[model samples]
Target: MHQLVATPFGGRGLILRPGSTKAVQLPLARFEELRALASALSTVPQWLIGPVRAQWNVDLTSRSVGDAILVREAGPYEFSRATWEINLGCDLDCSICYLGEKKFEGLDMDGKRKLLAVMRDAGVIWLQITGGEPLIDRDFPESYQIAHEMGMLLELLSNGSRLRKPHILNLLRTFPPAKLTLSVYGATAETYDTVTRRRGGFDRFREGLEQAVDAGLNIDLSLIIVQENAHEVEAMRDWARQLGVPYREYANISPTIHGTAEPLPSQSPQYLTNRAPFTGCPAGVTFFHADPFGRASICKVGREPNIDLIAEGVEGLTRLGGIAESLMLRTGGCSGCKLSDSCRVCRPMAKVFQEAKAPLVNYCQHGMR
Candidate 1:
């Protein structure tokens, strides 16, 4: 579907499909003008806007064209959303966590505030507050409040262990987030505790969900399917449905932030094999990730920092445009691979191959042989 996205260089990008390789870039003023014109002719059929569609290779007959034309326009900053890992300290130890056991010395309260301000100024309307467990951070309330006061839609990613706490619930009541996404380990306490390797995790998770729902908070649940909990997939979905809450399922498990494939052992090979071809990654194009220390990159897997929010401020974002462009160009072993259409190998993972010559057996079904 056609949609307006963010460019690495703090500009606008148009994606013809959600993960399609075809896209176009436009400056903020031009994008704004196009959106305005699209809104003015909202009732007209998209096919009638052939001239506009042709400019960006948009499918004229696609139903999403009109909706995309009048998309949420990013302000001067260009990026619509930002995922910030507020901290790396967690209460539970999940064997399949992408971050692994790497200790992160996050920014202080003032440093975090500066990073938030930079993100807000960049026109990021949606800020995802995540962490090893964001609720554990003493500065989480203040940082969350700052984003909320700035009128940014905030989404919290958590394990749901602390949501039952009186202070945590009080903070949420004061400034409710747009949504809270909790990761469900398993359907039963036995399986859940086995996956998380923590006693009483399932009980705490249930309590947290109950608290959030009772407080009238929107909640979304996700299951990261692994060998440890694959058998409980159906049961987990049924449980979520019974709660009348939305749920999603994920099968692919990538390496840790330190580029270690420790989580691969838990991944379901069949699930990884069923993925579609590598269309493109919206990393430098429409998405970005920032670690706890204020280092921003194109994506979480692509750890090469394009900007240091605390040290360089918003000006650092300007360097991302070139990085994004460079990433778009196929290079290394992927430059002329014949399996491009059916290959699930993404650029960041491919970079790992090119640099370390390590085969991501779990990520690539074909074994990259």
Candidate 2:
């Protein structure tokens, strides 16, 4: 695994690395040279070490380009980011989970390794490993390590249930992710446990979150503002500020991916925030989501006609852009609706809510206004 990486992003040259937030912009000429050297497995010129040092505060221990730097080859695909659901399993039973069902099933180790390889070839620069709590996946450690080695800037989405484990901590320290996001169900144990329906869930979450903070990992907090935990929203924000970690609030809870309204009952009416108006998105164009079984979709909410990556491999991804167009263009109940100019939810999300027979006010502008 290379210690540094040089790749093209949005027509610009970027130099980044694992375990650090700093990135250096490279001139096109220099970026091409580095990319060539990486492809050739050649030694890096003596000059690169100086800039790397100045930018990232690290000294290259090796001169070999393949060892000290991973020059990402420009791929035919335009994808720059992706999120994989390692597994749908979870140790907690949060009432507001969007995945709908939490089955502990996904690609096996060999299949997982293949999937990561495909992502690297497809030009994924930023990869988010999410789940019903990804850290609890049996293959997460090894899969995470392999992805880091392959030069994708990794991000993790979890519930802070397993971050305190020594092996997990050591693995993270060794190949740190670009960001580690944990969702705060509640600030107090009683409310938190009640939200998760898991005894001792709050204590475990606190333990793991504190350990992550102590490790100096790049951390973010997702304050889940649902009915069960809305009372603790302020306390959660204060705690996050006290810890000095970045925090964002997600006050909207929608129907599950399966188009089930089971999770909507937990929505806190007073806490519901207005969503920005529906606009264009780049879901299948530059980004996509992969479920536990390696079914690729434009996004989590639009799972139909998914490509089975394990069976068809990376070549199957070529059809996704067209699929994106087909799905995004179908406005469902909002088709030709004059209120669409003010509607916040997108076509896929609107479809899910419609399938669940959700109250119009929950997602439609007609009721919202």
RMSD of each: 9.3, 1.8
Candidate 1 error regions (>4 Å): 1-75, 270-273, 352-361, 365-369
Off-target runs (Cα >4 Å) in candidate 2 are 38-47
- For all candidates in order, the CA lDDT equals 0.73, 0.87
Model 2: per-residue lDDT, tens digit, 1-369? 678878888777888988666798877888888777777877777677888888877787467887788778776789989999999999998877887778898789999998898888889989999998899988999999999988899999999889889999889988989999899989999999999999998999999999999999999999998888887889999999999999999988989988999999999999887788988788999998998888899998888879988888778899999888998765667778877666788889999999889998898768855
Error of 1 at 10 (Å): 13
The candidate maximizing lDDT is 2
TM-scores for every predicted model = 0.76, 0.95
Prediction 1 TM-score vs. true: 0.76
Q: Can you write out model 1's per-residue Cα lDDT over 1-369, one digit (the tens) per residue?
A: 223332223545442222122445655665565555555654334433464466555554634325553244344545667899999989889888888894656999999889988887776766788988898888988898887655466789999999989989988877677688999999999999999999999999999998888887778898888898888889999988988899988887766767666776787655554556778766755557888999888877677756888998877877776676676566766777666677776777667544544455655556746
